[model samples]
Target: MANIVIDRIRKSFGTFEALKEVSLTINDGEFVSLLGPSGCGKTTLLRIIAGLETSTSGDVLIGGKSVIGLPPKERGLAMVFQNYAVFPHMTVYENVAFGLRMQKADDARVKAQVEKAAGLLHIEQYLDRYPNKLSGGQRQRVAVARALAVEPKVLLMDEPLSNLDALLRLEMRAELKTVLQSAGTTTIYVTHDQTEAMGLSDRIAVMHNGVVEQVGTPVDVYNYPATRFVGGFIGNPPMNFIKVPVTNGQVAAGSEPLTAPEETGNEVILGLRGEAVQLAPLPLGLEMKVRVAEPMGSHLLLTGSIHDQPVRVVLPSSETVRSGDVIGLKLDPNRITWLSPESGKSFPAATA
Candidate 1:
């Protein structure tokens, strides 16, 4: 296992700055994920660590030594690409043994290592099958097995589960975590899927426009987002940003005023999660006309407008409500977040 370090890495594709002084470190045996939307430079950062892409400036170190000048093969890393780059003509066993063969290991060593890796990935049963005969998840397992066969110092995965179906992807997520932990490999995963990053990673680096916005554990980034962009990006249904006129510590949503602990700016955006909007009633309430109600198996998602501004709320599936139904919602001040309109940074809000 190896600890990977990236120090102020910058990359430019002509005039387009692909990475703006990005820096992060993956500790030994730690599972870290680089997560962001497309063109955010998450993949570019991953490739830089793998030596597949050169950075315009900065340093990369593996196991406490600089690898900026090293070739990919000499970097002591194994990468699993989005496409599951397994040779279609080779059997699963042959595919897994290919790396060992390239390293000129003896037959006994290759067979032992292949057996071990296949067992780790639970793909031992399909050892004799060709890649074309394997399912997408199984093919992914073969690719993982091949990477593991080399016992790389660091493991890099680039959306390794993207090709799988929904259920298969979910299953593979659990399996991938277990396999990586058992092997004790330091991993850096890149994905655009927020759920995958939250579920699989010990820590996540949230990237935006080639810059890392925040790096934190799942709970840290989810609960106390450092920036409005993170709060908006990390959640499903996303957090609602309400344009309210602020005076002192209060926001006039409508008749009911939303107040924070201390005064923010003259015009501050209120960031509220859909789940945090209470549907019943409060002494001070904001009326919303329901535009849509979606039953999401466990929860009912309601999209509505408050004073002509859009709002979304999540209710219990047991609650029955329909479109055009006007309901009074109590915005939970404890869960309310005050954001700067210009800078998009969050500030504390008061809860009575």
Candidate 2:
């Protein structure tokens, strides 16, 4: 296991700047995910770390040693590509043993290592089968076993689960976590899926436009976002933002007044997660004409406009509501997040 450090990394492609002074450290044996949407420079950053792409200017350190000039094979890292790059002609045993064989390991050593890795991935029974014979999930396990057979100091995965079906992906997420924990190897995963990052990583690096917006646990980034972009990007349905006016130290929105922190700006954005908005008794809340109501299994998602600004609320599916109906909603002031309109940054809650 090794600690990986990225120092002041910047990348530029012709007239386009792909990365902007990005830096972060992955502690030994920690599982970190680089998460963002497409065109967000996450894959570029991952490629740079793997020595597959050189940075415009930066230093990459593995285990406290600089590897700026080393080739990918010399970096002592194993990479699992998105497509599960296993040779079609090779049997599972041969594929798992490929790295060791390349290093000229004897037959006995190769066999032992291949068996160990295959057992770890629960594919020992199909060792003699070719890649063409394996299912998508099985092929994925083979790819992972191949990487693990080499005992890499750091494991790099580039959206390894993106190709799997939804249920298979969920199953593999749990399995991958267990595999990495048992191996105790440092791993960095890159993906645009928020659920994958939230469920799999010890820490998530939220990237946007080639820059890292925040680095923290999933709960930290989701509950207490560092920027408006982070707040809007990290959640499942995303957060509802409303620019409400402040009058006499109280924010005016909908049909209610929410007390603002002292010394707040004239206008602030009130961010509300879906769960924070709820149906209420008719006499004491904002009245909104429902524009859409989506049934999501256990919860109902209600989309409507309050004060001409869009708002969404998540309620229990048992509640009766539909489109074109006026529904009363109560906002939880305690769950509200205040944001600065000018800078698009969140303001810390007032000191009580």
Candidate 3:
């Protein structure tokens, strides 16, 4: 395993800039994920690190050596793509051993390595089966085994779980963590799924518009987001942002005064997660008219309009709330997030 560093990398496709001055340091034996929306340049940055796509400027270093002019093979990195790029005619053992065979490894060594990798991935029983005969998850494991057989210095994965079913993806998430930890390989993963990033990464780099918005541990990013974009992008059901005026320890929406910590201005966004908002018996909190309620097994998703503004809240399944009924909802001040209206930057509440 080797440490990877990207220094001021820039990439462009014709007139469009895909990555701009991107820089990050991935430590040796650490699993880091680059996460963002579809067009946020996460994949582009990963490709640059893998030496598959050359950056227009700046340098990429593997184990403290510059690989700017090195080809992908010379960079000593293994890449697992979104699609399981296995040969249909070849058995799983052949696919896993192909890399070693290309390097002219002896047959005995290649056979041992392939068997070890397949066993590690728990696909040893299917080693003789062709790709067309295996299931999607099995094929994915074969892809991973193939990448591991070469024993590259760094492992790069570009949404490798995108093709699996939901249950299979969950299973593979745990399997991947175990496999990588046992191998002690430094890995960089790129994905648009926030859940995957939060669950799998040691550190997450949240990217936007060809630039990194924030980098932090999963809990830090979720609890104390550095930017409004990061806060909005990393949560399920997203965050509920309400425009409120704050003045002298008080916050209000239109004429209704709400409770919040003291602040400097009269214009700020009050951000709250759906799980933070609760339905109350009293009519003292924010007065919202429910538009719809979706029962999601364990929780109820309440979609409503607060003074003509759309808002969503997640309530317990036992709470009985109907559509078109006016309800009182409370926002936990400790759970509230504050964002600057002009700069779109997050700030903590004075008491929070």
Which is the leading candidate under lDDT?
Answer: 2
Relative to the unseen true structure, what is the C-alpha lDDT of residue 2 in candidate 1, on a scale of 0 to 100? 84
Pairs that collide in candidate 1 are 261-350
> Where does model 3 exceed 4 Å of error?
252-264, 348-352
* TM-score of decoy 1: 0.93
C-alpha lDDT score of every prediction, in listed order: 0.87, 0.89, 0.86
Shift in Å, residue 131, candidate 1: 1.2
In the order shown, what is each candidate's alpha-carbon RMSD?
Answer: 2.3, 2.0, 2.5
Which digits, one per residue and each the tens of the lDDT, describe model 2 over residues 1-352?
5999999899999989999999999999999999999999999999999999999999999999898889988889998999999999899888999988887999998888888889988999999999999999999999999999999999999999999999999999999999999999999999999999999999999999989999999987887787889889888678888888888889764577788866577888888787877787755776766899998988998888876888777888988888877887888887778888888877885433
Backbone clashes in model 3, listed as residue pairs: none
lDDT score, residue 297, model 3?
Answer: 85
CA shift of 213, model 1, Å: 0.9
Instruction: Rank the models by TM-score, top first.
Output: 2, 1, 3
Worst 10 residues of 2 by lDDT: 343-352
Write model 1 residue lDDT over 226-313, tens digit each, in one string: 6888888898888888877777777765456777546466777778888886666533467778999888889999998776889788
Runs of candidate 1 exceeding 4 Å displacement: 252-263, 348-352
Per-model TM-score on C-alpha atoms: 0.93, 0.93, 0.91
Estimate, for each residue in 1-352, the C-alpha lDDT of model 3 and write its tens digit: 5899889999999999989999999999989999999999999888888877889999999999999888888888888989988889899899999889988999999999999999999999998888999999999999999999999899999999999999999999999999999988999999999999999999999999999988889988886677889988989777777777667657853334656544447777777788886776545677778999888889998898776778788889988888877888877767778888878877765454
